[model samples]
Target: MTYCVGVMLESGMIFASDSRTHAGVDNFASFCKLNLFERAGDRVIVLLSSGNLGGTQAVISILRQNGKRPDCPSLWNAESMFDVALLVSDAMRLVDRRDGQHLKKNNNGFHASFILGGQIRGEPPRLFRIYAEGNFIEAGDQTPYFQTGETKYGKPIIDWAITRSTTLNDATKCVLVSFESTMRSNLSVGMPIDLICYKLDSFAVTMRRRFDPDDAYFTTLGKEWSAGTREVFGRLPDLDW
Candidate 1:
């Protein structure tokens, strides 16, 4: 299992994902689910994947390979974040076409999905959640974020703390805390956690970080959040019942 989130705000965007994968407790491993396709001054696209690792990797590989050929439309050539999402959905469909039947024959299913978000030259930053069926929905004013994989454990904090007007720094903290909340409840989702904070029209990713198990800041953040939560709970008025 994994957890990935993309938040689209009035100022910019935030993307994050945990790097844990496993077949079982004894076979735990790490694989980055975050992928970037950037053109420094023109665009910066981030992809956070979930579902079957093999299928996800295959879709990414196809995107990169097809990107190399001028005749093929690719993330690099896409004019808008919407178009980038379409290309991703197309690639997913391609993978399903090629390997879906084979995986099904062996009793496995081709399941993969992505959270695609970023900025292109002429447009503001945008976010989308692309499903396994080659369809997607964009983040809106009412719902400014998208999440995939093991999401339940981490959702409340985001819903409570994030908004279109939230600052990047605060959003980053909220996102990390959500990750902390998730890792605490699910061993399937572990560190190192990858994060990116992109400012509007920057067309570049100047802030990127990865927090491993031993990272000082992440550790402190988790502990403080736990303590704060308990403190808040302690303050709530007791019921007469």
Candidate 2:
């Protein structure tokens, strides 16, 4: 399993993903679940993926290999982030069409989802959660974030902390905290997390970092956040019997 999240804020957008994939307790591996397509000053597109590794990788590979498909609307030719979401959704559906039957016959399913977030040259930064069926939803003021894979473990903190006014730096901090929360609750969502931050109207990514288990800031945040949670728990009034 994996955990990937994207936050859309008035300031910009933040994207993050964990890199662990496990077939069983004894069989585990790490592969980057984050893909970035950047044209530097022109555009920056980020994809965060979750679900079956093979399926997700296949979809991404298709996007990269045949980015100019006329029928599918590939990412390279997409005019806006919304169009990019459509293109990604088309890719997911194509993958499902080709492999879904085979996987289902074996009692497996072609399960995959993605968070597509970025900005094109003339458009505002936008974010979308693309589902397995070639459909998607965009982030808006009331729902400014989207998450996939092992999402329940880490969603509460983001719900409490993220906001439209959140700064890029603070958004990064919040996403890292969310990741830390997931790693503590689920073994399947292990680190080396990929993080990308885009500032509004820049049409480029402002910051990107890889946070491994030993990264100093992540270590510090993990310790501090855990201690803070425990302290807050203790301070809350006890329930009446």
- Enumerate clash totals for all models, in the order shown: 0, 0
lDDT of 1 by residue, 29-80 (tens): 8999999998999999999999899999999999999889999899989989
Listed in order, each prediction's TM-score against the native is 0.96, 0.92
* Candidate 1 minimal-lDDT segment of 10 residues: 102-111
Question: What tens digits encode model 2's per-residue C-alpha lDDT throughout 1-241?
Answer: 7899999999888999999999997999999999998887888899999889889999899888876566656777789999888778888888899999999998987999999999998888888998877788888889999999899988999989889997888878889999988899899999899998888888777588998879999999888988988999999999999
Taking every candidate in turn, the Cα RMSD to the unseen true structure, in Å, is 1.4, 2.4
Q: Pairing residues by index, what is the TM-score of model 1?
A: 0.96
All candidates' lDDT scores?
0.94, 0.89
User: Which residue pairs collide in model 2, if any?
Assistant: none
